[model samples]
Target: MTQLALCVMLVSEIGCNRDGLVICYVVIPPPDQQWGIKLPNDTWTGMMGQLDRQEVDMALGPFTMTPQRASVCDFSVPLHHENFAIITPRPKLQSDVLGFIKPFTVQVWLLILTSLLSVATAMGCVVWAEGKIFRHSEKNIVARAFLWVFCTVTQESSHWLPKKDGSRIIVSFWLLASLVFMSSYSGILTAMLTLPRVTVTIDSLADLVSQSALPWRLETGAAILTYLKESKEEVHQKAYRNMGPTIYALLRERQAVAEGKIAVICDETSMKKAMDLDFSTTGQCHLYIAQGKVMTNAMMSLAFRKNSKYLVQANHRVRILLESGLWHKWIGKQVANSSHCLRHPRLDRREGIQPLNLESFTGPVLILLTGATVSLLVFLCEHLSHLYVQPPKSTA
Candidate 1:
């Protein structure tokens, strides 16, 4: 049995005899010496040491079965399987200041702008040709063309109308195109603005290594470190290299994660405990377990002294417990009884509906201001040009 209460309960339940006789000795190792690691002094410590000396009949905890450890002791059938994962702070809601523009990518926005300009220029040329052939006033054709295009984009009525059939046809096509463009923009923008944007910062180990903005660490003496160092995968190598040099204790790592100081790479079981602790205290689930699994089939089993007679019985009983779904039932009950901040994270209430600010309307507001400024400049330029052309007519 280990000092971790969950591990103690699990092991105690597994070791119970059919005669209702519970005859198992439990040893609590020093806090820093829970798992055995061979020291430079040619001596082992923790549960493995106690088992090696025949001081304890069995060692039970989240002890993973490694080739090195198996050499010294026999393992019972795995009580549970776990994966390596990263525990990160829950992503914050993205600022809405420039969120309105998130509906389309930069290339898309540029394409739309290019299309608008091309159509406006084509319409202006068509209008100019009609005026030239029919000898009608052709003044301000560019301005009128742009105004018509703007109105189409905004779905607003414009005073200017195309007289000729050819120009009308062009205008008709532009209106259809504008309708589609506007509809897509409106739909996408509404969804982006009204719905909260949740971001997963580190989805995979590769992502964890590539993103240098967040410092990441692992608890000292973690089993996953050995896996990372020996992994053939390039991503794992990179992640190992990028990990912070200073190893953190479990509580220190959890605190760092909660305070947004660092992200931690840990096993799923430990991650869940951290999450439970966080939720219980803060009344919010601030920690998120990354989706990526660094290593799978990491079997956790009870360790016994080499060729111990109890190994056979223990393996059989544990297998029975697993096959009968008792282990899963216990795990489910543990999770269900654990306090959670949200029943359904996606559907749960968020920091209520944030009041919409001017920043939230940045895209449309900037467009309106830009259009007004351009219109004012165009009006001033036209008035000045007229005055200059009229010369001294009033004086004469």
Candidate 2:
């Protein structure tokens, strides 16, 4: 029987109802992998995608039943829900550091400022180079002059322009100016980019490793763990060769942080769970390295063969799941209880009793207001169109 019909039938039978039978095959995602496993089509979209494509009967993992996804596939009355968190090596500062930064860290205003500064500086330099002083200089108006100026400003050598009389004066001063401005500009750009990297270090496992060189536990074959082991092996390190698969037995198996283990495993949401569990890993985790590090999040969805009824049904299911309040309930469970909070008074203060505003309601509220304005305009237009089409009611 199709997983969809089977599901309906199961639900129906359990509820003491006799319904018509409709059997259909469904493709299910195996729970073997962390992010959704791949189907025969060689695509992975987590469990939901597998089910939508009929690759699997239905995805039963802790798939997020987002409203957007519901428009594509049905989620089975939300299995689990959690918030995203980054785990890094513990910071050197007091535990309240995150509490402080969370309020006013690098925000949209900061990004906009940096972008404006970079663009303005780049344009200013370009304009200065093309200005009257350099343009009206008594040097020969050769293409080589332009190339020389451009190359010098960008810190590249100009092989075509020799050290001739006219080229000497212009080249010397221009090169000097470019060096000073370029150096200053570069410093600012570097600082802007590195600030976020440093702050978001907790977001990546490698960043944690670089910051703290302690052994961390990870499930066998996990992508993050695999990447770490591969990189470590490439350097021919003997200690990491086989430091045993598990971490200190005292730590929770799925939990990244606990009483004994120094690190945590699982996706971003799981990190939040650790804090919710009253685990004390927060404030300690830090970025693994300061340079040449990289990490990416998981992205996948259900597959479909063009337009199909199954696809439509799957999307509808996703919508219902998201709107049903199951996802939020799941998240509440993960964070509501904290063992650590009860044991340590100071830790509770950092976490605080005040509720967290997870979604940043400002953006969505503005968007909703804008949408309502547009929708009102559309409705007005439709009403006017209907009146115009009715040919002056009863004038005849």
- Per lDDT, the best of the predicted structures is 1
lDDT of 2 by residue, 35-121 (tens): 333345655444444555556544433343344445545444332333322343333322222332233337743653464344434
Candidate 1 at residue 175, lDDT?
92
Segments in model 2 whose C-alpha atoms lie over 4 Å from true places: 1-56, 62-207, 221-256, 279-311, 338-396
Whole-model Cα lDDT of every candidate shown, in order: 0.74, 0.42
Model 1 spans > 4 angstroms off: 1-4, 13-31, 37-46, 49-56, 105-107, 245-253, 337-348, 351-354, 362-396
Of candidate 2, the 10-residue stretch with the lowest lDDT total is: 285-294
Q: Which 10 consecutive positions of candidate 1 have the poorest summed lDDT?
A: 337-346
Candidate 1 lDDT tens digits, 1-396: 111455566567756777888866657563455466555675556677777677777776657789867777788888788787887777665546567678889998899889889989998998889888998876788999988898898899998897888789989998999899889989998887677666676877888898878888875655677678778989988888889864545554677787787888876766776776677677777777777778887888878889887777777778887899887676665445234632323433466677766666777788889999999999999999998877665753
Give me candidate 2's TM-score against the actual structure.
0.32
Cα shift from native, residue 126, model 1 (Å) = 1.8
Q: Which residue pairs in model 1 clash with each other?
A: none
